[model samples]
Target: MEFFADIADVAQVKEMQEWLPLDGVTTNPTIVARAKKELFTLIEELLAACEGIVQVQTLAYSTEEIVAEAKRLVAVEPSRIIPKIPCTQAGLGAVMRLSKEGLRTTVTGLITVPQGLFAARAGATYVAPYINWVDSMEWSGTEVVAELLAAFEAYGLDTKVIAASVKTARQFRELASLGTNAVTMPPETYKTILEHPLTDKALRNFADNWNGVFQEYKLDSKLKG
Candidate 1:
């Protein structure tokens, strides 16, 4: 499964890249506005820093306007930007057009199986289901993911499901168990994925043992590579 950083800050993006095998980055209007800089410029910097596809959202309400923003993003980095269109009527329309023109698109903001089906029909390369967002509404986010996965296989759609708005490691593990194609989460959440008291205690024991044995031992200069 592919993992993406759901972050907007460039420094955090760089740190995530340095630590993990990041596949991409995802951002929305709220995220973009956090930088307080030129939108596309910041996005381009992020794409270049990570050297991976960055899903950038469109704030437009119409299909034409959405496509226009997508076009501008592609012009910035044709091969590394995936226009993030919502799974709305106009958004799907724009996705259909953009996909037909050979541009990769990520249809985000999905909450239902029908929305996922429509996104696949519109030829989106990826479908993002907001896991926590749906669960916040007291809906089964895992159910949404499960239904979409089954529908995609039943219909033989090539579109991938990107589980978005992931809040915790438990949610991430559950989504992975449900077979989500990809997941986008905050860097902090990803860092906690492998954190456990037992693991830390074991590492400390190993380090203490090693230090006890190698207190005065050192590699000779001739042994250095």
Candidate 2:
């Protein structure tokens, strides 16, 4: 399964490359604006920075606008960017049309299990269900994650359940255990994984020991000549 972080800043994009475990990225108007970069310009930069998937949302609020945005996103570079649509009927219609055009579409918002199912029915490539947003509203947020994951597998939808708005490592673990295909976090949470004490302890222990460690060089006396 692939993992993604929902970061907007190009600086964060470079930071993620340093940590290097995260697999992809997702951007919306809010996030794209955070980086102080134009939508198309950000997409171009992301295709260069990230060696993984880039899920880019269309700014259009309606089906017709979304279709136009999808065309625009595809025109830049089809391989890297997946067109993201909201979970409205018009968005679903746009998803269906773009999907038929052989463009990847992701459905995202405050998604319920049924929404994810509907998105899959529309042939969406990714279904983004909000985790932190759901919990903050006092819902059994984790259950929805589990439900969608199972529903996709059971119904044989090609859609990938990407846990969205993940706030912390625990939530990341929760979605992971549910067999979610990916989780998109903010840059802070992405950095948090590296600051974990356990990971630090493991490296500390390894560096402190050198019991009979040996090294050999295959290079010749004159620069391996």
Candidate 3:
């Protein structure tokens, strides 16, 4: 039920924190590059602005390199930085090694039940499934997430499923209904999820009715008297 902002911009992170119940922030190479700041500098700013864990992706492709990079990244903020590793053999190896050191890790680029299970077995704290990518391949991303949830519960795995690449509010709602452990989405998508035309209309109607009856009488004034 955790909502994470999948962004690298510090200002947006601060804004989302103010308006939403944000659990954390997630970032990839693409997101970081878009921020146009030094990697560590941006990470430091994000960690300072975010009140929770910040997922930072590792660029290394080998087990040793990924492990080294992850260790370095977590050293920046041991309590809050979680390394994001790809769902590859090397990445799983790194995750296992890092987990043994009492550090948390996220397994990203996941798309299948078996892959997710394997990441769980490797001691990943979270597994991210690309919802939109799965749907683009003529498959149901929601179904894939549901299967992952069932598998995790059936196996009694502690690893959580964090659905990623969500594009629409309906998709977001579907994942939420399935009780996915967490979801990370862009700020725009989160805004879309929070808004509804009917809700706005209802608010407008309430305001009109209240103004007509109250005639400039404020609720605080009535309460104070």
Candidate 4:
């Protein structure tokens, strides 16, 4: 599965890129607003920093406006920029129009199987479901994701599922198990997913054993003589 950082901070993105196997970066209005930078300026920085595609959500609500704004966003970097449209009637129309033009688009804010089905039928390149948000509404976010995957497989659709709004490592693991095409989460959540107390303990034990046996002599130094 692919891993994407759902962040807008350039510095944090650079840091994560250095250590993590990041497939891309995803951005929305709220994430961009937190960065306190102009939209286009921030996007340019992200384009340079990210090694893969960068998802930019459209601010417009209507079909025509959404298509126009998506065109403007894609003009920055045709190959790397993917416009994220919300899951609405207007958004679906925009998605269909953009897909027919050969431009990749992601339908965000999804929460139901029918929504995903419609997005796929509309020719979306990707469909993003807000996992945590669905759970907050007393629904099984992971189950919803599972059903979407099953439905896509049943219909043989090529629209990839990119699970969004993931908060915990368990949620990440659950989505991964469901064979989600990609998942976007915060940098801290990625760190948490990679860490375990037992792993740290095992590393510490190995270091102690090596020090007790080798003392000041390094492995290469001992081999030199």
TM-score order of candidates, top first: 4, 3, 1, 2
- TM-score on alpha carbons, each prediction: 0.91, 0.85, 0.94, 0.94
Name the candidate, 1 or 2, with the larger lDDT value.
1
Q: List the residue pairs that clash in candidate 3.
A: none
User: What tens digits encode model 4's per-residue C-alpha lDDT throughout 1-225?
Assistant: 988999998899999988988889999999999999999999999999988999999999899999999999999999999999999999999999999999999999999989999999999999999999999999988998999999989999999999999988788889988889999998998889899999999998987777666644466524222
- Give Cα distance to truth, residue 144, candidate 2, Å: 0.6
Give the count of colliding residue pairs in each prediction: 0, 0, 0, 0
Candidate 3 TM-score over all chains jointly: 0.94
TM for candidate 2 is 0.85
Report the lDDT tens digits of candidate 2 across residue range 101-216. Answer: 78888898945889889999998988888888888888867789899878888988888888887877788777767778877877777678648888889876764453224232
The per-residue C-alpha lDDT of model 2 at residue 24 equals 74
Error of 3 at 109 (Å): 0.5
Candidate 2 stretches with Cα past 4 Å from truth are 198-225
Evaluated against the true structure, the overall lDDT of model 3 is: 0.92
Write candidate 1's Cα lDDT for 1-225 as tens digits: 898998888899998888789898999888888878788788878977797788899889899999998898888788888989988999999999999999999998898889999999899999999999889999978899999999999999999999998887778888989889999988888988868889999988976766676643344322212
Tell me, what's the RMSD of every candidate? 3.5, 5.2, 2.5, 2.2
- Pairs in steric clash, model 4: none
